[model samples]
Target: MNSSAFRPRLLAAAVSLCFAAPAIHAEEADVAQAGQALASISVTGARFDAEPSLAPVGAIIISADEIRRAGANDVNAAIRKVGGVYGRQSLDGSPDFGLDLRGFGTNSSQNLVIVLDGVRLSENELSNAVLSTIPIDTVERIEITRGGASVLYGGGATGGVINIVTRRPQANSRSASMFVEGGQFNAGEVRLSGAQAWDNFAADATLGTQRTDNYRDNNEFKQTHFSGGAQWFASQFDRVGFRYEGARQEMQFAGALKEAQFTAYPRQTLTPNDYGSLDSDRLTVFGQRRLYGHDIAADLSYRKKTVESTYFYDGVPSPATYDSKQWQFSPRVRKLGAIKGMVNELVAGVDLTKWERTTASGFSAADAEQKSKALYLRDELRFDPAHEGRISAGVRREIFDKDYADPLTFAAYDAKQALNAWELQASYMPVANVTVFGKLGQSFRVATSEEDSYTPLFNKPLAAQQSHDAELGLSYASATQKITARLFRHNLTNEIFFDPTANFGWGANTNLDPSRRQGFELDAEHRINAAWAVNAHYQHVQAKFRDGVNDGKEMVLVPKNTLSARVAWTGASQTADVGVQWTDKQRYGADFANDCAGQMPSYTTLDARYARTFGQWEWAVSGQNLADKNYFSQAFGCKAGIYPSNGRQLKLSARYSF
Candidate 1:
């Protein structure tokens, strides 16, 4: 018991389960068994809404049965149960997994924006979104849209967006499944999945492989993944679908540890022959139609990625390679009528992109090209329908063209940018279950092309990174309980970061003048009967730097309180789950220096799962962290440290279906 005294009794039992969630109130057939004990619904910031707590902001849905009841092995462990989402993986999880929303620190993949199944899986030269290239067994849900979606997914969304839906085909379902696991240090995994249908057509597939031999010491890892999909209906409302995914990975980078080598060898390895490698491919196609009253959709995608790395500064190695190709197109239309007396719904969209990249080694060789386009519109208004009110507005116009070349000697770097964004939302329910919302937004990001041709050599004057976002929300749902609360704020201006005093840590990509991030969030769910249930989330953020010389410091790994809780039980067919998380203590070097010295402490973790079934066979056991916690999820140098977060993980699994 010491984690500073068991972390205030686990943050006072997660604030007493958020005030006992309105003192549980079941009925309506116990609310579908309490919404299956936490998860589902919430279609990410509305649009043909699926009720994300009556959208207007704040959303988090992670189904696929909550990723198999949180045995989650990707999407950063199922997006850390929402709260204020945070994730950073290393020390064995291999080069990937880094996310932070609503307070983008360390450039969280250039401020969110990750979608799949609707294409657009980021990466304009490291605007990452490689959650192991989809394979939480082909996720079937994963909304998560908290704020500022850049007027419908465009340009690094400025802290929001994470679609990722997968799994299709229904008609007359057919199934197949397989999973296997092994744990403790020399980990292991295997997965195979299937689905099928006939007549109107359908299909699905998944395959996976994972390996680990990590606990430091040249952190080992290897991975492989693949996904497939197909669908067609062609009638009724017409539809079509297609998907494919692939991945290959390799790792070995053990490079951070200092603080007396993390109290003497926290799995040692401060650059054990640094390494990295990745390969990827993706394809997507989508279609939908329903003319007349409108409801059209279209999507197309293609992607390719390749990366190689070798680093070791003082020890000299420095290898580099990155190859990329991408193409995306999106089309949208939706409509609902009656405007004179209120009642309206309209959505419009157009986004297209083309990208190419190359960054060779043996000294230098570069080529980059990018093109983007965007046009967006949204409208939603309803005045009355029994205690109701709604209004939404959106606008977007984006344009970019960036190029960087140097095929031997024709050195160049060109850029052009155009941006416009807007969003305004309002909602009210007055009763009939409660809802209240507000939002105002704007987002932008630019200055890529490898940060303008190989990150400065004497060049400076790169701009584009703007944000202004706001949110206010409230929600309550009856029939067993659900709650949401929010208050968010963001104000960024020319805030591009990565400057460890110019270039010591591969930094240099600087800009920071105004910065601010305000926050308060809470999410709750309850059902204390029908086999127990509970859920909780909390966040309190304040990230800063609102002027000159580190105006108010803070904001470097942004974390000022975050908590999560979960509990579930079923019985008849057997199930059990438990969860806990807390993070608070962060600061690890940011521009405008905050007296440096680096810090990152504050951690708590626990996860559990149990499953049982027989008819079609299923069995499970899971554990992660579970009090074997001694954390430090991230930190970098200038003497900061390096990766070390992963301890106490156990696994056992079996599954079968036909």
Candidate 2:
């Protein structure tokens, strides 16, 4: 896995590919034709391959080339390129990667909707889809709609949405690549992918594996996966595709950090038996097809997941081990320009899943299962001749098991709730240089299974959460820099947040009313020279629960301000990039005064990276946390906490093209 070995292998592959076919060079004018081939890739919400000068809300795109430069080993690290994104391995030494869309909260369990190639990874447990359930190796690109997309995507889209787009075979080339990565935190990984194209047939496959020693003692995680797809262009008017993805992930929990661990000045560590571990396996199969017209297409996906988790506290079993399984699927169809002045596209889908738990101590023999389903359709209106204006609206219905109650209190009361959502968006372009836009949408989030059937010691059932998103932005394109600015806000109701200290109970889902999160973002990308580019982004957030159970309390785990800047140099022989990020920290808990803990301190960090390519080989050398700063990303239950982050670590990696 050394750079030298990678270099030779890559050279050999390039030689083979070149000699395998008759060498022919195209003309200079053909460069555009060659580049256009890459543009054939299209996504659900992408207006076109052209990057929008102004985002509908706030967003960032990290191309595969960008990931390679940063030496990203997996999608978890590759996703950090976005301005507001942050990732961490939670206390259990497990993969708890999360995104703070529109500044809802830190962890995935808090809020946010995640999707993979149009399939709902957590379709069944919408509100509880943790990061470990996903296999990052297959992600080609991630499309993030930064604000709540509940209008079209109902449920759990409280903070917004993440659409994971996997790579596919192109009609023009067959390429293979393999790489290995190693770093601090006892991390190691290997990934390989191959794709081929011949006439009307194409295929692709990806294989990967990873392991990490507990950054905390005894809390380790290991994962393996395999995925592949094949497609046939039955004719110029029709096409169909089939794919399969399977994986398993395991982690030994290290429990929440103790106050002593964080207070330790120089170094902190975990003790044995902080918690036990669990392992899980998941498999999925999907099929899709497209009609001749550039206007119609459809796809369907199904997945099954089985998991086992254990718990240990005080060096003894805590009776928390459990196992479960589920089956889920989503089918969708889309049509473009179905009308003249009134353009329309409709997407209707349903979700079905069942779960059963093994009877265990401290937990309950509460063997129960649940099912949920939904169907939605949205139509878009675009008035092109009368200037530029577009409108979109949609709605959906949901049903969940209500009888799955706690066995101790066999007060079986199962009922299903149905909700409706809608959205409206408008964009105007008076001239070429400017485009003004505005949006308003209503979305609701369903409760997790745990939340649905629970008594917080002495409290009652927690209510479902809901919110609305409103936004406005302007885009100005210039010869050098492309400037885009946006101002948005989210109003929430029945927000469910963990309350460590509450009346009549150890913990309860406090209903916060009339709360809101507001923020502003400005992004600019400028080409300084033919070989140099500069990008800068600024974000500011002000969030708090305005009323109800948690009133007047500064929001927990929310960063008030952030600033990021990067300058990249591209040359025929090498590329270099350097970036810096500054963050203003806030608090770690909802009501700190009630829990005797104060607000968190703020910190800043800097990073630098460089990469070079020669022939069929590539190499990268980078330094993260260059300043070696120590700070916290998240915490829990007062003084005990583990910052889902590492300290001033260095990374080096190489890739071979074979």
Candidate 3:
């Protein structure tokens, strides 16, 4: 597979996904009008709006059109198209696809903050995001602010921020749409959505189901989701809103495997050791009012999630069964003031959460739970309409509840800890067409007792995790093209992991080392002509271990180079698109702290789609993996080989609206 023959085959396959548009040379008349204009105001803040370039930091604004073009129901696919974003699958399990920001993979939710509207979506325990359950249909747009935002967000702001804005109540519009398609390896999907508006109140709902043979033999999937919302204006001075969402998913789980089967038998048949059920529901209520020449706002949110899993071998359930639950609420208060020559908006908030987990094993019984709380604040000052800069800062203190241990399992242990984080962020627009931003931040995490002193076979306490992040970015745009690039670095303390060893053959969480990761990324959008459009992004990341950390190990399983591109053509009655993605070798082992493999091998994929509209009938056809390059994403495991990217799949779909 490493022969020179590989490059040509790869290039040939990738070229097939492209749908070259009929090119038309642009007239000089249009070139002059493409004035170096930059994009403006983004809804990633308190009022669901703000001028990001003017804010002085790095923010990735994803439009609704981008969402529709991705052609995938899962939100992960939406972000995956970006350079700095990646998703991971549970080893030997279904490629669950958890959101990763700036290379901070799974179970690192605290660093990668996720917010729905204004409510926190990351929970206690793992303090990670709930990416798999959020329905794409419920999202109007998403703004991803890269770099530390804890000065306003709290603990999870260590890595950065993701703000999801739900669809707003539409005006003078009524519509409903549905799509159904079937593809390679028994993959099929159906999606439906409807919306209506009357006066000042409106609402929308969406539902979808997708089943696939997955890239591996025993890997398969099924997901069901529902989302809806309502809003109202009580008076000229008062308003209120409510939203709800629920989802259920079941899938197989495979732990990472031995190298013998990992490389030598990358495609050999494999089996799953467990099955899991993930159920989640969320609700939100918010209110805003204008009084005494100032506007005030607040919100209350509630979330409940449970992960139930049963492990088995040869049809017999094992002791690895796990059950967990979470309860959380975050509230905020803000005041907007307009004075003589200045406008000031101040915001403050608090987050409350409690979580519990229990595992019953054929070998051992283990149980643990924690309750966490955080309070924070931020403010913005507006000086001039075209030349305004702002500063923000905040700190959060998290205290955990007393540990509760499973009485029957002598091998189980419990522990509690705390962390205090602080940060400062600023943004500025030196010119109307350009923006610059920077941030210096410090954030830390209390390690789980498991990371310190725990071997599945032996209970031991491990150390904690602490780190700091710094970022700087610049953005430029014109009518024809827009570009954004950012550079960032993170230094760590007590880098934790489950180390790999002989008796400790399995990775057990441990934190006795230090490390750092530095990276840069560029995202560009260009309109080549009336019929041609291009979306391109690239990233480079490097991780190095400090002396004696993880035994001075190089960060593995994290790709150092990633790239993505999509070119599209739209005409009078036809639309076409081509996309490609590539990733550098990904390091993986039986566990996080042990046996680091050199790489997963660099791989690429090409895909294309075409659609046409004639009268009341509409149809589309899509081709995936045109080169059939056998590849793998962090999404694959043993049974889910990171390399099973479907052997060239094509799906054709047609629909009619009466």
- Tens digits of per-residue lDDT, candidate 3, 1-658, equal 2212122222111111110011123344432232111124345564334444233256677776666555545555666653236654433223334556666543344457777777776543442354555666667777777766655555556567777776666556677777777887677877787888777777777787777666555556667778777778654336678878887766554333334554564444444544555667777787767554234566676666555555444678643444555566665565544333344456666667676656565653556666777766556555554755666665666665535565565655565666767777766679986767677777665544233224433555444466788888887877898898889888877655434442333334456467787899888889999999998878777766765725455565567788888988888877887888777876642223435334566878787888788876658888877897765554222222233334577887664543
Quantify all predictions' global Cα lDDT against the true fold.
0.70, 0.58, 0.59
**How many steric clashes does model 2 contain?**
3
Q: What tens-digit string does per-residue lDDT give for candidate 2 at 413-500? A: 4657676676777777677767677778777776654544443533244566777888898877768877878898988887765544
RMSD of each: 24.1, 10.6, 9.9
lDDT at 84, model 2:
37
User: In angstroms, what RMSD does candidate 3 have relative to the true structure?
Assistant: 9.9
lDDT, candidate 2, at 411:
35
Candidate 3 local distance difference test against the native: 0.59
In model 2, how large is the Cα lDDT of residue 462? 58
Looking at model 2, residue 425 earns an lDDT score of 74
- When summed lDDT is taken over every stretch of 10 residues in candidate 3, the lowest stretch is 13-22
C-alpha RMSD in Å of predicted model 2 compared with the true structure: 10.6
Off by over 4 Å in 2: 1-41, 46-59, 106-110, 123-138, 234-238, 258-260, 265-267, 275-300, 338-362, 385-387, 405-413, 457-460, 478-480, 503-505, 590-597, 642-644
Best by lDDT: 1
Best by the TM-score measure = 2
What local lDDT does model 3 show for residue 47? 35
lDDT of 1 by residue, 288-370 (tens): 77675466778888888777776656788877777778888888876645444444556887888988877677655877788
| Candidate 3 vs. true structure, TM-score | 0.83
- Compute each candidate's TM-score over C-alphas: 0.33, 0.84, 0.83
